[model samples]
Target chain A: MAEAARPTFRPAHTGFTDTIATVVVWLIAIIVTGVFVWLLSDIIWHGIGQVSWRFLTEAPRNAGRAGGIGPIIVSTLLILAVCIAVAMPLGVGTAVLLAEFTSSDNLFGRLVRRSLDVLAGVPSIVFGLFGNAFFCVYLGMGFSILSGGLTLACMTLPILIRSTEEGFRAVPDEYRLGAAALGMSRTSSLIHLLLPAAAPGLLVGMVLGMGRSIAETAALIFTSGYVDRMPQSLHDSGRSLSIHIFDLSMNVAGGDANAYASALVLIVILLIVNSVASWTSDRWLHKRIIS
Target chain B: MSRSRSDIFLIWALRCCAAIAGAIVLLIGAFLVIESMPALQHVGITRFFTDASWHPSADASQGTFNLAPMLWGTLLAMSGSVLLATPLGIGSAVFCHYYAPSSIAKFYRRLIELLAGIPSVVYGFWGLVVLVPLIRQLQPPGPSLLAGIIILTIMILPTVALMADAALTNVPAQYLRGAAALGLSRWGTIRGVVFPAAKSGIITGVILQTGRAIGETMAILMVCGNVVQTPSRIFDPIRTLTANIALEMAYAGGDHRSALFVSGLILLALIVVLVSAAEVHSKGRIYG
Candidate 1:
């Protein structure tokens, strides 16, 4: 038995398998990321040098050479503005209700919470269908900027409410009790105390929701018709960057440069919005830790 | 005191906003049901479920809106994507948790986060230009089930990886250390002890990822080729329920509309089953 114990270092040449697995995993991660980059490269490699400030300012090309995304840009900003306007009050208002006044398991409260989750889960295309039927066919609003913005507002509502609710809950109950000791009502305490503390976080959630809305394509495609024109009326159809990229790529007839360039621009926009959100959340977390 | 009363009233009113958001969801389900009723009555539920025949363009006199083909296609594509993504996702997660340098793991997390950030439509476009061509090189046609699976798999990789990594992190270090102390190698300890402990979480993540695959629409529609036929083979073209609904919703008439709603209901049911099972399995067991 002592002699047998001496032979433990036989070393079964397992290096090959371990090395192979490590390399394979690393390569897969690299290649997957590279493909995403390469997609942008394929488009910008063709169209980046061609775009100018003028390209961003002018209306889309009618003659099919190389026009700008001015209308798409304006429309996107407009829709984004409209969505923010709708979602902010709606989302923060709901969050405050859940955090302060509503009792747990209240039927309507539970229903609202569950509904928000379900709304978050429903596919974008389904939302598109609803918008088509309810907004276009039933409401007679047609495929316009207003319809698209309203639908987007609905899409962003859940994120805003959920995040804002979390923000409100994070504020200490001690603060509320202290405010009450000073003859402040729950609402007064929330407005003057709880809300200010929650403001940074509620704002972050709004940015994230806006990013999600901006990056959205399927929901907007049917709700907002692929109108190439700048919006003159709320009823006027307008193209956002996502729609423009989808449309151009579908034809393969529209220059590949335009589509790729549009995608690159849109991706950059999303990154900016998402980063702002991430930064905001991080700052709040750090502040909470320090205090 | 009057100010306080107004404040309390404001809070009560704010609560209604939350109710409205939730009401919107129930309304969507109700709306879909109502819109599809005409088709439901005309076809009779039996034919819609049992029959594999779908001739949307067929003469109405013959009566056909068979969902069987579309359902089969949906399952096949999801199954295909799950098969491709799950192992890679788990592998990546394992590497991130146990093997990669701290910097590398952080980078990997950020990369996956960015991947998740890309809109579904961009994935759709990439599939159109790049992935389709790559698949065509392997097979003759540009758009096939293979292409759809490849795109969907890539699209879901970040979600699965993030969840799996969280699961792995949740595994206790004590078990791994105890295994190592007893005379196991690092890999051996991980393979034999850590992974088993993480199994419930891993399995739940896999099921949830499957649910996501089942429900995904836009990226899938772009590459699925949108044909209405039973999937014959791995490489054959097919139409998924989501694709069918997207492609036809513009002008679907009568039972054709209800057939689409039935397709959606089927999808919702599949997701509900997967989610409920995971919920039960994961209730208190998952560490992360």
Candidate 2:
């Protein structure tokens, strides 16, 4: 009876047009892949020659025409640290509040979500202008590491909040129900159960946020003056690796090789950071599914 | 009344933090409006937006603040890039969804992800080092509108491809099976049924790509030649709104600085409208 009721559909031979379409689409995909391989090989071939101990450790001279990027590397790390420090807590707190505390259907929740959407869509250059107006001038932080960090924090806040909120939403509702049955208070359950379960996703967001802070050049170009020396404190102006790459490629004549090398380093850093974030997220997801 | 004081305190603290996140968006809007007020007042909104010349300080008596050329350049570059990217992106999506084997599909997906991860500055570097010289052979000025458009097309392809792939995959298996049962060819099914079903999703991706193309700066800055003129040909040099602000903000002050802020404001307004439109379309249901 079941066999009779099931409509028998045989696999049909593909027509010529179908075959042509498939082949064309396949060629297109291969071309995109080929482009990627070409870009990577081109950069790595030209850039790998510039990386060395001396290159990484010594301060640049001759207006970045020669020497190393030690100060630039330090300043990049410093700026990232400050950006993450300011953004992480505020972002996570807001995500937690939105996910667990408030009803998403509520007007306030809707408004908050809309605002985040708007913020996330904003261009980085606008953030540069804002940093120049608000942080460097209005707040009197000047074009220092602090100003750049703060500027990045604002740029990254919306991203972190959205990602963390997604992370929270990924938590199964059963955990909350079980905690309720166990008479666990809302705060305690969030601290002890929901947070531990959501830790991996949150880490993914944090790492991604770090990547944004690291890759940022435009906002930093304004809020952080292009000073070549190693910054002794947050108040002093600094140059990040991305900014260094920009300056070398644009401002100076015949600084192409160094720019390529620094770009290789930047891409390498980004790859490592992205891979770790995805790997951690996948591992945690697997573990959650297993036990 | 029975709630613990600590619980109340904790809730309030989290709420305050959340409010601050929302408030930042409003604050940015307010700050841009206020900072740009000087330019808005000096040139008047009509002249600032309508004038084609961008002499911000030709003389104390009269400084031109026209935004026509920059706006024209921004739209020209964005439209040129997005139009070029859309078909290639959709084609790649079709390949991934239908043609590729599982291993090849996975490999291609990872390649696209890595492409998306590459920084805009790296794109700019490659453009300056490789693309510009290549273009120089064709056009005397290497950093032309064509270069910017090409760089942006490459940058946005991965984003468009990924989004489109997701949309294509989300087309129900039942639809494909039904078409197959009806004796429709694979290409016919994709074109007549699957494409229509995934239309909204693909539109969403294109809208998102448009936003990115408009907002892109560093790469365009490196290659757009920073000419404050309307581009008559693909190889003509032009200055986008983003490049204009980045180019002059360092030395600009008083009314000149305010003019830059006003440019930023216009950009912000444009982005908000695009993003909001994308959001609305994404939420809209097309099929019964």
Candidate 3:
């Protein structure tokens, strides 16, 4: 009512409104950050006491109620090894094919891209079902590490392919033209130049895949029988760290502490792997900038 | 140089490897259909979808493999979590993009990424230990759909927020400047300009979150007491398809196992639809 008399360019309470907006935004940000901090502190506080050299190296006793996760660690690593072995080559090859060999406008390329998207969204539990039906029963692997590893490999493939493809696509056309101008064969050029350039970015993908493998629980439950001991061979059933955490927390008496400890370890490993991934990629970018 | 023998062989091999990647999706679908065929044939597809009961091992005279309850539970939990998460995630993104100082925003974004990178099983553990207990003080029978929904909301928040932040950040600054030139308030500019510009992306993020929520197993399984009944209230126990498979597949055999495969098939179908919808939505935006 008094706006004309006041002769003000802005509303009277504009500053107040801005303050309110800032408060609300900060409140949300803090709450979100608070929840994460709480979760982390809870795990670290409870789990820190349990991490010991013996805990890392010794075998479980009395059905995993009162022992270490040594074998679980080994089995986890072994399954990861099997997974990366299969997924790395297949994923890198697929990425190379999509980025280099095919045009995105073509039907085959479109179909492959769509299929990759669909695969990326496929639930881990379905992978478990597939692993059970195809690898475990039909293939008669019988709830072994091989079945779990194979299933995880399949699950990791999409992540690997997508990231690697992005890495390849990020390589400018000038690099390829430069190589071709040198009279090098296409295969030789790709092998010597493009792949190495993409390797650092692909490492990020591999680390992410490794993180997924480490974190997986539902997919491995049925395929990898919840055995507590060290695996004798690829055919032998074994428990992974995630599965052990699940089984112990749910099944064993007084297993919550152990579960917490295992979870803490898993979280720490994930953080380290992810940081390593970013750090390596950052280092590569830094070098590129410097040069 | 002309293409060498090794070059041709390498190209052929790489193409085959690419085909293998595509074949994986087809293979999973084929295996699921094949494994589920027996159950589908026995139950009749219509009855399987319409039946209210899910007794896979009933007497030959009274076998009812209705999946309505699990389906309902999955939809309820997924939608509930997404509804709870969407506003919060988008709000966080808005704050990060338009409100916060750069240093604060950077730290906040890092925290969100850390949250995203935490494993689902640990979330399950936290739900079982911290969240459930906290809920118990307010409500009895803490392991309920509400618990599952809350845990899912937390799990998916980082993803949705990150996607939304990217979308919001990508909104051309010219629009913001134009809105300011028109004397629009900050929230007004965001509502009228930023939101419309980023509509497709936010929907894609929401759809992606839905896919993850529906497929979520470990945390939901731990928090949502696995009762194969229709949940009437937020505090009621319910089962999701993912949880059902994870809970029963261990000891299941015969038709029960095949029936589990059918559940997996349904989940696969849901994911395929959601993912393709998201893909189409993103593609449409890319051109327009």
Candidate 4:
């Protein structure tokens, strides 16, 4: 210790601690980043060449056979449709009731708002079980697209409701007062002026909600059983890209190669959807800021 | 027409539905109780929480339940991840907001956002492929809590960082400028002014990350080795409540199935505490 304090005996260590710290940070960051990239690369690098025209169009077959994400793609779109239809209305309606219609002091208003927040926090796995218990056993819908979609609705409603509420709340009060002074009815004013004014933010909410519903796998599992065939109706069982990825990762034997490709595709889709969400939101909000 | 009775009634009705969100939480509580009653009747509540064994006959003719080990595992895994992530997450957030060049900070922010967009399964597989083999080289030959914790730390980094960054950003810029004018060093100004202002926000982020770590399923399921024992060491594999529900529900029958619902109930209770904490903090105006 005395030798080190002499400064000459110190091991050429001006920033030795900093060098070690930087090395450690880079190691941690690189490994984390590399693992993320490897997960995608392992899949896409192997699967992309196979992701030809036929692969996209054809159905997935038994292990190692030819198949595409056809049914999975349709299921994704279908779930998105059903989820948006159910969740958006419930969420937007709740938001409307909160922001414009009801005073928060009322018991029901407080209840709705809090429950939505709680609902948002409920884990996906629990939602899956709830879906299974209520919808599968009680409703007799069976493991179908509709049931999964509806369950997803329950899952994403919080996001939609809150965002929509924010959108409505964001509408300037002055605009409404000015409309009223110009002799517009409240209903007409809300529909023609307020809703239109809040439209972009509301749309952003819907887009983000759809993205969430699309990415979900766990909740839909119990309610939407794995089916290889295309959905005949809302009652028919189906698989989604997310569930497909889950199924492959779990059910496959040694051939983890396929799972990698699927992971890449899923990551790509997620990026696309999220970017679209942000873009739409920025554009919408930008217009609002200017207006 | 002037506002009328039906219009008011309809508005009230909608408000009633709006409040249905709160009722939904109650309904979920009730639903779990109802769903688990048969199982609870079969096995006393104490047995469910105390007993260590979880073997149910394939036929489910025999009752089987125990959650203590899983609960221990859940707590252990969450604590591991939170302790590791909080410092690094908050530190990175501080460095980016206060130290890094604006472009570099923005880049890091974007990187964190993209990380958030990656699905849990991808994270799991990344662990399965990379972490599992890496762990095997160590003393352990299985998934283990360390792997799960490390993976979870990364998973929650974006979430904690974003929230904390927002909190720090919300600190009045004038505070930092005032501190600079007082001749304090840059680090001292941040330590003295910015941190105190953002402490509540950072705490809020830590709490939320805890919630995420506790509730997470898929990644933990894959990386936790799904062992049903209380952990003796960080490398010791263990099953968590979320993993317990996931692993059993697919094949669980009778009481076993209902017990999984009971697990859900417990998780719901945990989440309520989290939500209420956030609500309390929000009401207290704790730097939201």
| lDDT of prediction 4 | 0.74
Task: List, residue by residue over A157-191, the lDDT tens digit for candidate 2.
Answer: 87788778777888999999998888777888888
Q: Tens digits of per-residue lDDT for model 3 on A1-291? A: 000111112322345566676677778788888888998999999999998989888898877777899999989998899899999999999889888888878677677777888888899999999988889989999999999999999999988888788778768788899999998888988999999888876898899899899999888988887997899998989899998888877778888888888999899999998888767767877777676
Candidate 1 per-residue lDDT, tens place, A1-291, comes to 000101111223445555676677777777766766776577567657757788788888852247888888999887788778887888888888877777766776766765675576666776776776677767898888888888888889888988888788888888888898898877667779999988877988898898889888777877877888888877888778887877787654855677777777888788898888878888788888799
Model 3 CAPRI quality: medium
TM-score preference between candidates 1 and 2, better one = 2
Residues B1-288, candidate 3: write the lDDT tens digits: 588888899889988888888889999999999988877777777876777688776232356787889988999999999998898898888777777766777778778878888989999888888988878788888889999998999999999998888787668777777777777666666777889998988989999889999999999999988898999889988899999899888777666777888899999999999987887889822211
Best by TM-score: 2
Taken over the whole model, the C-alpha lDDT of each candidate is 0.75, 0.85, 0.84, 0.74
Ranking by lDDT: 2, 3, 1, 4
The CA lDDT at B277 in model 4 is 92
Q: Can you give the TM-score per candidate against the true fold?
A: 0.88, 0.95, 0.94, 0.90
User: Can you write out model 4's per-residue Cα lDDT over A210-255, one digit (the tens) per residue?
Assistant: 7777767778778887886778788888888777776676666653
**Candidates ranked by TM-score, best first?**
2, 3, 4, 1
B-chain TM-score, every candidate? 0.89, 0.94, 0.94, 0.92
lDDT of 3 at B105: 73
Error of 3 at A202 (Å): 1.1
Candidate 1 residue spans exceeding 4 A from truth = A1-24, A63-65, A102-108, B1-3, B49-52, B57-63, B171-184, B192-205, B284-288
Overlapping backbone residue pairs in candidate 1 total 1
> Regarding lDDT, does 1 or 3 come out ahead?
3
